[model samples]
Target: MLFAHDTEASLAAAAELVNTAHETPDGLRTPADVVAFVDRWSYTGRVAGDAEELAAVRAVRPRLERLWHADRDEVVELTNAMLRETRALPQLVRHDTWDYHLHAVPPEADLAVRILVETGMAMVDVVRLEELGRMRICAAEDCDDVLIDLSKNRSRRFCDNGCGNRTNVAAYRARKAGG
Candidate 1:
C-alpha cells in the first residue's frame, strides 16, 4: 500500500466527506444525510443527533476539501489547527476485526471533533512522508470531486466514480468531430 491501511482509510473517508458537497442536486442538507454519511464511513463516536452536530461536520467539509489542492505549508497549518482545536490525545487500540491503530480522541467526544482529529492524524502521516501530492482534485472539467491517488507509479489522475471516463470519452468525441 502507498500508506498505512488506516491512513488510506482516513484519506478515503475525508474525500467522501468533501465530495458530498460537490455537484449534487441537494447538497448535504439534512441531519439524516449526515448520519447516513457517518454510518457509511463507520465513524464511531458520540453524536447528539441534533442539527448542531450535523452543522459542525458540514462546516468541516470545506476545510477538508481544500486539502485536495493545498500547499504543504497550508496542509500543515490546517492539520495542526484541527489537532489543537480538538485537543487530540493519541492512543493505540484494536477493535472489531482490525488490528492496532491510533485513536486520538475518546469515542465519546463530539462526533465532528473525532472525525476531524482522525482525518488530521492521517494527514500528519501524509505531511511527514511528503505525500500530500497524492491528494488531488478531479481532472474532469466539470467535476470538483476529490481523490486519493495511491497507485504505485503515482499515475492515478481522476476520481473513481467515472469522472475520468466521462471526460476522456467527451474529449475523444470532440477530436473525432473536429478531424
Candidate 2:
C-alpha cells in the first residue's frame, strides 16, 4: 500500500466525490444521491438528508477537484484552508470496522464539513510524504474526472468510470481498421 489505509480510503473518497461533479446529469442531484454516497464511503456523521445538505456536499466538489491539478504549494494552501475553515481538531477514533484513525471533527458536525476536513487530513499525509503525484486527472481524452494513482508503480492513467476499458477498446478498433 502506498499510504496508510485511512489515507488511501480518503484519497479514493475524495476522487469519487470530485468525479460526481463531472458525471452526466449531475450525480448528486438529490438527497438520495448524497445518502448513497455517504453510505458507500462509510461516512459516520450527521447527514441532514435534506436539500441544503445536498447542495453543501455538491459545493465541495470543485474545491476538491482542484487538488488533482494543483501544484504542491497550491495543494498545501487549499488543504490548510479546508482545515482552517472546518476548525479541524484531530483526534484518534475507532468506530465500526475502522481501526484507529484520525477524526478532526465531531460526529455531529455538518456532513460537508466532515468531508472537507477528512479529505484535507488525507492530503496532509500525501504532502508530508511527497506523494502528491498520486493525485491525478484522468488521462482519457474525453474525460475530466479526477483519480488517485495508488498503484505501486504509479501506472494508473484513467478514472474508474470505464475510461480505461473504453480507451483500450477504441485503440484496438483503430488498430484493426489500420491493419
lDDT by residue (tens digit), candidate 2, 57-171:
9999989998888999999999999999899999999999999999999999999999999999999999999999888889899999998998889999999999999999999
TM per candidate: 0.93, 0.98
Per-residue lDDT tens digits of candidate 1, residues 1-179?
87878788889999988888775664578888878887777776666778898888889898888777789999999999999989999899788766888899999998888888989999999999999889988888877889998999998888877987998899999999999
Error of 2 at 162 (Å): 0.9
Candidate 2: residue pairs that collide: none
The candidate maximizing lDDT is: 2
